[model samples]
Target: MTAHYFIGIKVEKSIRTKLTEWQNVLAKSMNYKDWTSEEDFHITLKFLGGCSDKTIDVYKNKLMNEEWPGAFRIAIGPAGYFGNPKQPRVFYADAEKPKELEVIKLEVEKIGSELGFQTEGRTYRPHVTLAKKNAEGMSPLALESYDLLLDESYSMLIDHFSIFRIHPQQNPKYEAIAHISLNKEE
Candidate 1:
């Protein structure tokens, strides 16, 4: 079977729990499909379309060898709706440091290209999607606006990175096919 793949930041359990709680509340205020499970939630760094097993292995090696600059603190905020708010589509928590995040994003895209995967050339904006539209009507909400406060801030210690393959099925599963753990003093 063909697999859909992407690169993402695997959040620690502690951070995941906190983000989930906040997401639950925000999801309730919007009309959207609930996430399959908390485990399925992740911040995608790159979308690496489809690839053969050989290609995946080659990219996995590259990712394992690439060094992270250091730990970066992501201050997430600026809640807003995407598409048309009336017939609302996506609700997201915007990433504050677009330039900094783009640096990493570009590197990941480069790796994906090296692996013989299609890399998108579109402008990137880092955001955690809170919700997506469903059959339900738009849930009216007063989206909170702020000067990029830390709705949930954490230092993403870049010791490791992973590549996951997404299954094609209802409530699809994501399998981590490869990872590179950084040797940093924790």
Candidate 2:
């Protein structure tokens, strides 16, 4: 059976714990219904909607054969939202020094396109989605409050990327299908 898949950089466990703490604080004040589980916290490189096992294997092999980009550091700098503050739809943690992340994403996109996945037309914005609005709009006041809380920074070292299979409408939504180490000598 085909499953929806995406490529992402894993967040370290200590960082995940910190992020979860931040989410818990936000949950107490905001009405956002969907908070990403700590296990699923990652920086996405590409999203491949639905693909067969054969397709996933092909991509995995391609990634394994590709050159590794050396490891880099990333940090949570500030909180931000998609859409206007009055009606914010997504709440996210911005990455500090995202250049390396961008390079990885572009490579992932190129490989995905070569594999016949539709090219993403929108400009890539690298952020870890913290929560999503469910049924109600986030008040501007709440957004402002969260923005203030984001001043404290959280950073981590990135050494690998992975292909994850997502089970639609399922809790603990993502499963790592393949992992590719970065900065490794051949």
Candidate 3:
């Protein structure tokens, strides 16, 4: 079987629990084909469709040796959707764009391209996916704007990213194959 991979920021357990609760509430307002499992919540950096183990090894080694921007805090923004609001294709919590995040993303793109990985055509929009697609013949929602789930200002600390392999038959479909820490202190 082919190994499908992506680079992403892992969501902490506490944040996952919180997001899952918020997703539960959102479910009452709108319906979706798939609600993201808490374990699967993440902000994708790049989606690398398929690769050979040898290629994956080379990519992983390069990442380990590459310089990354130091850890920074990324705020969780309000709820947002792609496609129509009432009948959305995807629903997610946005992550504030920090230059540090951009640096890492761009670096990943550069390195990936060097390794013959296809570059993403769309501009990167960091987010933790909540749900996707309208459920089978689901009714359209009013789609009132939803605010950040956390009270006051909230942000997640970023110190690392990883290459995760997809396991479609699993609860947590994405499994981290390699973790690349970003200026992690001892």
Order the candidates by TM-score, highest first. 3, 2, 1
Q: lDDT by residue for model 1 over 1-186, one digit each (tens)?
A: 556788876655665565566566655554466453456655678877776777777887787787754455565454556787654577665655544456667888887776666778666767666567654554344445522232546544444657888875645366777875644655
User: What pairs collide in candidate 3?
Assistant: none
Please count the clashing residue pairs in each candidate, in the order shown.
Answer: 1, 0, 0
Q: Per-residue lDDT for 88-135 in model 2, tens only?
A: 678777776467777778888899999999988998887888888644
lDDT of 3 by residue, 1-186 (tens): 888999999988877877787777677677787889899999999999888889889989999999888888888656666877666788777788889999999999999999999899998899888889767432223334443352322478999999999998889899999999998654
Q: Which one wins by TM-score: 1 or 3? A: 3
Deviation of model 2 at 75, angstroms:
1.5
Judge candidate 3 at residue 25 and give its lDDT.
62
RMSD, candidate 1, Å = 3.8
lDDT of each: 0.63, 0.79, 0.82
Off by over 4 Å in 1: 34-36, 98-100, 139-156, 170-172, 182-186
Give the runs in model 3 whose Cα sits over 4 Å from its true position.
136-153
lDDT of 1: 0.63
Between candidates 1 and 3, name the one with more favorable lDDT: 3
